[model samples]
Target: MTGLVVPAAARVLSARELRALAEVAERERLGWNANDMSLDEEVLFFLLPYSYEAQPMPLWKCRVIAVSGGLPVEIGEGKRIRFGRLDVSLTTFRRLPVASRKAERQLLHWLAWEAAVASWRSVDEDR
Candidate 1:
């Protein structure tokens, strides 16, 4: 049996956006960035906002898997790409809750932010 194939749109999260995420992470005080982390069931999954105009989405999503040398070596989703190892600044880590409901709320907020940004960009492009 052949599995159904779905065409997924590509998106990217720019360094600036990453910085924002980092700031959030840092505020949460996950650590001084890159402080070894353990892979838990709770992962930060960022959603990419759909846009008609093709602008590289800044880091589709980031997974807080591990921290090395104060750097977050986590998984990231890129536009039409899947990054196995990705890193974020201390700030991003701050926004992420190591283990709590706060983490889930933060994830939702991040997703909403991405969607809003994508929609805005698409509208701007049309103009």
Candidate 2:
């Protein structure tokens, strides 16, 4: 199935920013309908611009390759790999307890920060 990916150069948001994002996600989650595929896709789509300043990465057919250390890592050839967890469907998302959701948000933010650092290093290496 097609998936969204965060761009390599996307600025990893700071802790403060992440908190804000989580708040937004929570709000969205509150009103989300688990059975509505369109709404679910829209929520996922909403995150795209946050990570891409230039041309957005194309959606790709992808699969989760691993879930090491509680992070779901997916791969799609020729497509950017997003650091945050994007695989949680609305159905699954609604089933998660509030604490679990909070934890997930924190983990995602941390992963994004790490990805940003790695991306910066790669750019430096190219110089």
Candidate 3:
């Protein structure tokens, strides 16, 4: 009945990173299994939404490896939590990424700064 949780600091992922992870999930969905994942790979397993309240999400026999931050992580197939290859079977969802309100503000600020810089560069190039 245990569910999985991810903190924001354990890993930082973008939409593009999540999409890359989907590629691995798609492989699992296809019936091919891998033993370990690479840390350099940015994909993470998306846990089942309803299973969050469960004491422990069930574990499937098959295991896969996911690499995050340039290392390998291992995980069972049945759990609802997302994990890197190094974090397999650890049951510590606190490591997952969780952003505080302050963190969100900083993220937004950085995003705006990056956009402005990009636009300025583009304008300068045309001049």
Candidate 4:
């Protein structure tokens, strides 16, 4: 999957921005289905972009990786992994303000619905 450098200032920071960005990208990447994603993924889809604004990370240094079988983000303090600044701590990432709770909740609602639908479809496929 070719990577797109979504500029920090231009990154999806809010629910409105998330929906707008995701809708267009979803169309462009034919197989990239939000319904196939986990709740963690749905959150990270925006959080990854929000990292630039929240982590005080350099926009030029920011990058997003979109590949199947991605690993879970590490959650710990003072557990340096050699290249310290290269990684952004999600613990710190979540502390900053990004979107309104109402908007965030709504986005989550849509994701949860997607998961439910996917499960329903999967049940038939398993038969």
Winning model by TM-score: 4
TM-score, every prediction: 0.27, 0.26, 0.31, 0.32
* Residue 13 error, candidate 2, Å: 25
Clashes of 2: 0
Q: State the lDDT at 98 in candidate 2.
A: 36
lDDT of 3 by residue, 35-103 (tens): 333323344332211212222332222223222322232454221222322122224333335444554
* Predictions in order: lDDT: 0.36, 0.34, 0.36, 0.36
Query: For residues 1-127, what per-residue lDDT tens digits would candidate 1 score against the true structure?
Result: 7643222422233334444555654664422232333222222333222222112222223343221221222366322211232334323333433433453454445456667888999999999
Q: After superposition, how far is residue 80 of candidate 2 from its true place, in Å?
A: 17
Alpha-carbon runs more than 4 Å astray in model 3: 1-96
The residue-by-residue lDDT of candidate 4 on 1-127, one tens digit each, is 7565443331223334334444544454411234443323323333434223323333222232222222233445111111001123344334434545554564455456566877999999999
Model 1 spans with C-alpha error above 4 angstroms: 1-99
lDDT of 2 by residue, 44-112 (tens): 221212221121222211121111222333454121233232223333333333334544464456557
Off by over 4 Å in 2: 1-67, 71-99
**How much does candidate 4 score in TM-score?**
0.32
